[model samples]
Target: MNATVAIIGRPNVGKSTLFNRLVGKRLALVDDTPGVTRDRRPGDARLGDLRFTIVDTAGLEDADKATLAGRMRKQTEEAIQDADVVLFVIDARAGVTPLDAHFAEVARKIARPVILLANKAEGRAGEPGIYEAYSLGLGEPVPISAEHGEGLSDLYDALREEFEKLEAAEGPSEEAETDIVIDPDADGEEDDEPAGTVDRPLRVAIAGRPNAGKSTLINKLLGEERLLTGPEAGITRDSISVDWVWRERHVKLFDTAGMRRKARVQEKLEKLSVADALRAIKFAEVVVVTLDANIPFEKQDLQIIDLVQREGRALVIAFNKWDTIEDRTEVWTEIKYQAERYLNQVRGVAMVPISATTGQGLDKLMEAVFDAYKMWNARVSTARLNKWLEGVVAHHPPPAVAGRRIKLRYLTQAKTRPPHFIVFCSRPEQLPEAYLRYLVNGVRETFKLPGTPIRLSFRKGENPYANKAKKKR
Candidate 1:
């Protein structure tokens, strides 16, 4: 409703490039790589006399490579349905491939008007492809070079015409609305905890893997043997969401049975434990993932972080039994490096090195949960966020791909729970995944968003808004 346009197409067809172009800067990476974009990237864009929001989608490769069109395909279709207008981009260089034709069929199914684009038509070599693009049955394809910045004037004209029709047909009452809500944190606290809904106090889930002191730490944090404490693995079979208050911050700690791999969960109790812990993760607003200092980085740990990110919840990481580790210096360095490398998406992710038994750094651990919770509700103003991004890019330049320089254009927040941003750039495909990681880490450290996922996406701009606003006058 607030000026959104969706760019939908098959892989590597310069949709992202067109995104950057309309945005009037390189906010995305333009590369020859296909299926590089895995998520839909939304950006504020302007084209000639037209200014609106645009969304660039992941190439439809996963659909082809998929074993089945299950949940993911359904989600993708929903996302497409949510869009305003669909800019159907096709590769003018390759002409209309079978994939492109398939995409056109899908586009036709949507309620939105389709704007066909024959991108990568800079050279004389692409003229034949431009002609062939018309056969896809979405009306005439506007030829434009996403890479070389050619035929953009014609793109502006086409877009202007389409928007004019849209304006004429739409109700005049449709207007953008803005509100300033100052307090989302007040809503973070559980209603039942404060309201006394249950006489048995609160139910909190303190979950993690084997021997990360879920029992020992909960015991230490609670100062009791509420749950059995032992070095033996898989002792806590059922998830016990217990009640406690830390400095008057009421908590219902769920001491869960240690979760092992699904195949390794041979025992019925262990399976029950895993299931309970998973349910706890879903129910609880804030989930703390514990890690052993000795072996911190693991595939399961990363998966846990991803789950938290997807759940739109708050999270904290506690390095339990940190007091037992002798080589503290090396461990901290390794842990920091691994977190930055593996969990870059979790911006400002809270990392606390705590010893449950010794009670060392327990206060810091508690502090982190409060902080991460606050950050989960954190909203950065457009002015401050862009300012912060400007400083970050100025400090560390973007990485170059091949001979071409990667350009990061204007940046803005798309949405937030765990703060998400869209970076308009040239050659969004050309931008390396690692560079996106760099920006994520930078956002985490700079914005003080630790222990939360900060999604940073590169959007390629093409049809680069040919400054035809002057001519429109």
Candidate 2:
């Protein structure tokens, strides 16, 4: 991977589809719904012989001051600035919407070269719209059907041209920079647990809207008021972190400042507080988004889930103040349903209804955390995976595509942390979502693991290999 090519566009324009195409993996979710993607999704991209780093970005919406969309816009702009080439995608069939124009205008400000991609252009329906995309004023729209694997030759040509320009002028893009800033003796207060007892302690960040029991949960977990909590909002600031010992396991716990809706955060201190909280999330492996049981579902809460998915981190959603809810059963069901409905990108997210006050379900919460952590670290033996793959195909066969039954040749666990398995087969694109879920559910059931996010991607290939890549992180 050399050049950093960012997949950019308005919502639902197949940017993620093209990213997966080049990356040779379903690393990002592909849904028909607009604004499905909400964060910077970086993948090791291979466009034939041209290997480059591709960043799949959220749709750029013209958001007003103090909104989730506004925050996303800020993040997306940062990604564009970092990119070497911006692949501006537009939905050909949908024909340039108003938002498309807005995005194109915004993209012109970036110093990098921008190439327009007219996606979903396989059929006759998209011909006129593909031609219409020339109005974006970047360049000729490279018509591509990302889902059907059409029009990569043109994309390859465009990439080659950009690389040549950079080589001739900029003298070959620099090596991948080390982003980690190791502060061996960074001036900071100590956490609860001793430092050296653990090997790479899991970084778990706790976050939620103001007064959402985030500090309370941290206090409860540490068995002390390590972080100050108050009825007044914004008690914790500066993103205070501590090392925690849970059942002999060590974790570096980041108790972040309370994130409020941007509008209410008028003061300078509050804005810095929000930024500190965001930084905590960036440095976390697993984020425990503690929600107020009474007021759980908010726009900011959905944004938090979006952040977790974007960061590619395992999440354990803890509904705090569970004891306060009057109709426990009803509220719990409703909250879970809403979470599922809103955040569907990461399948099977671990959601626990627990009270941080009384410690009821904290044991279950810890148990769930361990399960999620294990799932994150889960590595299936290749021999065992293929063996189980054979059994799954033999038992409940893949459903018919048009007329022929889908043929699944083999399977391999690509990567894990929520256990991502890839099945190689004939007509993988045609494979039903129900069939894929059936296999994923089967794998979870077979392993006796439930409630952890399990991702099973069906690809049309045999034995894809990463030569020196280890099975587990």
Candidate 3:
């Protein structure tokens, strides 16, 4: 296992900035606002020849145990316990505040090796703060500027020493070797591979509005308090991804921040969180949009579902908090009616009612997710598609446009995973949008592709007689 390093400090001390630098990417959200980070986020980090798992945690703060700030502090404390080393950072330009001193005392009590980082010590202004940090009793301060990338060499030396000590105590680790064999007798050619059957983990992202129990659902699935949750809305800020196996199927689940309407989202931090959640949707193969059973099929819920369909991703609507509702029969009937009414564009989408808190309907939710994944990756042979197309066209021929009937000559699936298809037709541009929808719906129904997005395009068929006539001339 790689060495784990956790960066902990008071709000606005550049812990996230240092994390981004170590990871060599903007994996964590950075802002000038205090307490932007709320959960512990981990990323694989590399510095020179050294490699380790670096964790970016929420700023350490003092608050009531029931409050949101207190919950954030708990997450940071957990990171400190899990890490092999702790980077206790302080803002050198601002000098050490009382909160810093208090956390310094807290860090001293932890058993892990603590590295005091006097961040923002790029110039003479930070020199006094660096000296002040020495009074914290952790050790000599390592002056480094996390933003401008200064004094990392010294920081690396400090970390290297700690890691060397750990290695000595734990003993050397053996490296695994992978051998690849090539076939010399076979001709080199790339073959079209099928989808959904690969050994890689299935990427499933859970998204919904605030307090929709997205984090709770993920925590229940993980069987641990992996994510910080409370009665507070928007407890989650970053889109955190967790890896797990469900019934021998490897799955990478992304728990995204709650998305609110644009008009209501006035803060820049909330905007960043919403953007992160949208990115998770784009990366996921299947998105589970959690909905509160009390207020099912809200305007925002439909909008989120529409966005997923527009992004050409497989979608499953999970009505969370099912245990809270008393009228099961009436509510379930209304849910089905509303789903059909609002989600007619993507017909036959999977809707599962689940209680994330009680684990009720959890099995059904997973089954729906896997089913949607399979449908998303479903592919059809060209022969079968064309044969299906013949029957479709014969049953309902294309309407005449400008006294000429448009003909669909052939249909072929361009790709799977939210299946895209191209149709060779006459006057492709003249095909009406209504007819296109008809064809898309036909494909969805005929191919048993429910809950997954379908893409259909029309292209004018190439005429062989035109080239033949030119050759004759």
Worst 10 residues of 3 by lDDT: 189-198
Task: At residue 435, give the lDDT of candidate 2.
Answer: 78
| lDDT string, candidate 1, 275-355, tens digits | 767877777667788878777866766777677777766888889888889989988988888887887567447788999
TM-score of 3: 0.94
- What's the true lDDT of residue 94 in model 3? 97
Candidate 1 regions off by >4 Å? 1-205, 267-269, 298-313, 322-349, 389-409, 424-431, 457-473
State each model's CA lDDT, in order.
0.70, 0.76, 0.90
lDDT of 3 by residue, 295-401 (tens): 98899998899999999888999999999999999999999888889898789999988998999998899989999988887889999999999998899989999
- Pairs that clash in candidate 3: none
Using Cα atoms with residue i matched to residue i, what is each candidate's TM-score against the true structure? Answer: 0.48, 0.49, 0.94
Clashing pairs in 2: 191-243, 376-417
User: Could you give candidate 2's per-residue lDDT for residues 158-212 as a string of tens digits?
Assistant: 9899988877776533553654546533645333323324745778888888788
Off by over 4 Å in 2: 1-196, 235-237, 260-279, 327-351, 394-396, 399-405, 432-434, 462-473
